[model samples]
Target: MQKPEPMKDQVPWATIGLVLLWYGTNIGVLLLNKYLLSNYGFKYPVFLTMCHMTACSLLSYAAIAFMKVVPMQSIKSKRQFLKISALSAVFCFSVVLGNVSLRFLPVSFNQAIGATTPFFTAVFAYLMSNKREAWLTYATLVPVVAGVIIASRSEPSFHLFGFIMCVSATAARAFKSVLQGILLSSEGEKLNSMNLLMYMAPIAVVILLPATLLMEENVIGNTIALARNDIKIVWYLLFNSSLAYFVNLTNFLVTKRTSALTLQVLGNAKGAVAVVVSILIFKNPVSIIGMIGYLFTVMGVVLYSEAKKRYG
Candidate 1:
């Protein structure tokens, strides 16, 4: 008798465990990033992102080289490569924006707002796939928006520019999620999430280099100078960046192994963890409204997750 064909959409229990681990690892990444930025400065965040991406890119390159899995010749079309590269670049930008926000905002608030990515992603997915969404999904939007407003109360330096940037950053992140889902669904190649991430760093560096030079204090020269004076900062940046990538890669794997639903449930802890880290490390002030906001945000995430499970 022939073996039964594996169901592509079936989720496994091991993936559930992985998703939980991903949540824990992400919390660690948040702690490290918040600690570094609040204690140090933007230079730390910049260096961390650049260096971490460099390391991950190198590791990914090494793996591909050893397996002799050079960009699959079939998918080596310039147009395809450019498309993937563009997606990766956008991801990198979203990441950098989040990092920059960490410098000014509390981790809890940042992540609380960031969590809205799923909602935006749902909308994008609906638009991209041209599928109609269920009423339940739309219903959850009210809580999600309210939660964002609540969480915004604790923002350390809430300016119009910063608020706009943070919102844009969250939306961009949502876009990345939608794009990745589309890519992974359509692409037939052996492209793992890590592979996608590995391609991102180099492309991101290329895209952000000009901005770093013009907007950042002194770019490479300043970073180099700072590194020379404080080697600890280098280590901090390296560790934070590396951990962040690892967390993300782990998340993708976990979601693949388990159902996205499991990860969503487990990921609800990120905001609380982020909040504690911000309070303890940064001594960020929180008002009654902010606490309410956090609860609402968490509720929105839960509601959104359930809606997807039912309607997705």
Candidate 2:
């Protein structure tokens, strides 16, 4: 028999669609979060995050069960459930803190702080697992840290508490990512991103409920009062929560279709798009130095992604 030629790779329209969908949902949720927390007078971050997790839990179930988007996964053991609950706790902490920070910080400056996630990730990896990256990879983080410093100094609406919360949220997010890998590294314990979300969402809701009740005084009463005043608040919560689920779904779909490096690069671009959109929509004042600093951080993120891809 004659040897056959291999087929060439075609343009990934599906992946492209997924990436665009991811961006839309991600940015939509971010903008809505800012609007709800800052402008809309919904100051309960834990409650807002609870709404998101509740939506995720319900949507994930429907997608897996009725829509058949992916095979349904169940917790195999108590240990696995515990691990997922731990992750959910961390996830809730990061999300609640991020939302809280949004109340006091402009989305652009917040995103600038968030762009330094890789720096935290690298640090956590080394501290937790003694993992070391190439020198170049570490060097790329210099600009990442420096940019935040410059932006913080120049930000017109800088709030120290918001900055601290954002940085802590970023660190907690990095820690969760690292912890997930450690907790689920074994083949038997591993779950796909969808399944992970499915499991984590409900647990996160459980974790957030008590915290919301304890930490946010009269949140339920306030929400009810707000709804009585403006029924649109309910609609906003519904829409924002739905967007939250889609954000996770599209993110997993995009990563599944493309390389993680591609997702990271796309994320860098997404942050810039978000910053621009938020600036236009919220009309938040941004100094020239602040913009320059954000650009530097984004550039550093891109370089870090490239360096990680090459070195790893």
Best-performing candidate as measured by lDDT: 2
Q: What's the distance in Å from true for residue 158, model 2?
A: 0.4
Candidate 1 lDDT over residue span 174-230, tens digit each: 888777766656556436665666666677767666666666666677767877998
Q: List candidate 2 stretches off by more than 4 Å.
A: 1-12
TM-score of 2: 0.95
lDDT against the true structure, each candidate = 0.70, 0.94
Instruction: Give every collision pair in model 2.
Output: none
Candidate 1 TM-score over all chains jointly: 0.82
Worst 10-residue lDDT window, candidate 1? 67-76
**Candidate 1 lDDT (Cα, 0 to 1):** 0.70
